[model samples]
Target: MSAPYVLVLYYSRHGATRSMAQQIARGIEQAGIEARVRTVPPVSTQCEATLPAVPNEGDIYCTEADLKDCAGLALGSPTRFGNMASALKHFVDSTSGLWMSGALIGKPASVFSSTSSLHGGQETTLLSMMLPLMHHGMVIAGIPYSETALLNTQTGGTPYGATHVAGSDSNRPLDEHETTLCQAQGRHLGQLALKLQD
Candidate 1:
């Protein structure tokens, strides 16, 4: 068997969510566990248009095996109408086999989101992401109140999960508080994963 790792899987449209994923991965590594970063390809409304097997740039695509074998998971996505983007949701929906087998049962999982506006349903989106993991029987982890960033964050940090406000143009970067919360969530999940394995 391969060494256990946390899967940092996300779907990024403007890169803010992707940046948060990287920070989460850093925290997982800081916890002395491997972090496997992966992304899903954009979904097109038109069925005929398909993405290449490999993305031209950025993180490689996530595979079923990656999801099945992870020691823990950090799922992220851009908020769309108070929910996760279709691309990430599509990937999650494809994991029924894992769900049926309970492959993720007892594993730790957390969620994060990016939105173009501060009130763009960040918490709801985080909740939406959690539903699938719950169905798979994964233990959900969230940013705890003890994290000072959650108390002081002016931009984006929540008990549900880490978040980033990307501004209207989706050009805003993650603020210090947002970044800190993301890392904290990752580290907490990693620690939980290790302990649960014992």
Candidate 2:
């Protein structure tokens, strides 16, 4: 068998969500598993138009094979009216083949998000991301209360998943609580993946 890896998949317009994905990946690696960071291309409205096979910047584009082979997943996206971004959603919606085959069943999964405002649907976006994974039969994981950050965070940290308040300008870096929760969520999913592997 190949080494276990947690796929950190995300889409970010201004880089906040992408930063969170990096932190989560750091935590996943800290838990003694590999972290494969990937991103989906933005969708265009022009009929039949498509993005290039590889993104021009940041992480490489995620492949169906990456999703199929991952032992765990950390999905992230910027909130779009209390939902995941259209680009990430578009990519995930294309995974029905895996869902039909039950290829992702029993894998561990978690979610994260970043929003422009404090109440801009962070939790809802996280939950929205989880719905399809649940349909794929993946076990959902979230940040537990044991992570002190959940209690201390005034910006963003929820039991549903890790989140960040990027503020109206989308320039605010993750606060301490956001960082800790991201790491904790990543570690939580990684540990669960290990246990599930055994």
Error of 2 at 118 (Å): 0.7
Model 1 clash number = 0
Q: For each predicted model, how many residue pairs clash, with residues at least 3 apart or on different chains?
A: 0, 0
Report the C-alpha lDDT of model 2 over 29-68, residue by residue, as the tens digit: 8898999999988878754235576777899999999999
lDDT of 1: 0.92
Q: Each prediction's Cα lDDT score?
A: 0.92, 0.93
Q: Over the stretch 2-43, how does candidate 1's per-residue lDDT look in tens digits?
A: 899999999999899999999999999888899999999887
Task: List candidate 2 stretches off by more than 4 Å.
Answer: 46-50
User: Which 10 residues in a row give candidate 1 its minimum summed lDDT?
Assistant: 45-54
The positional error of residue 96 in candidate 1, measured at the CA in angstroms, is 0.6
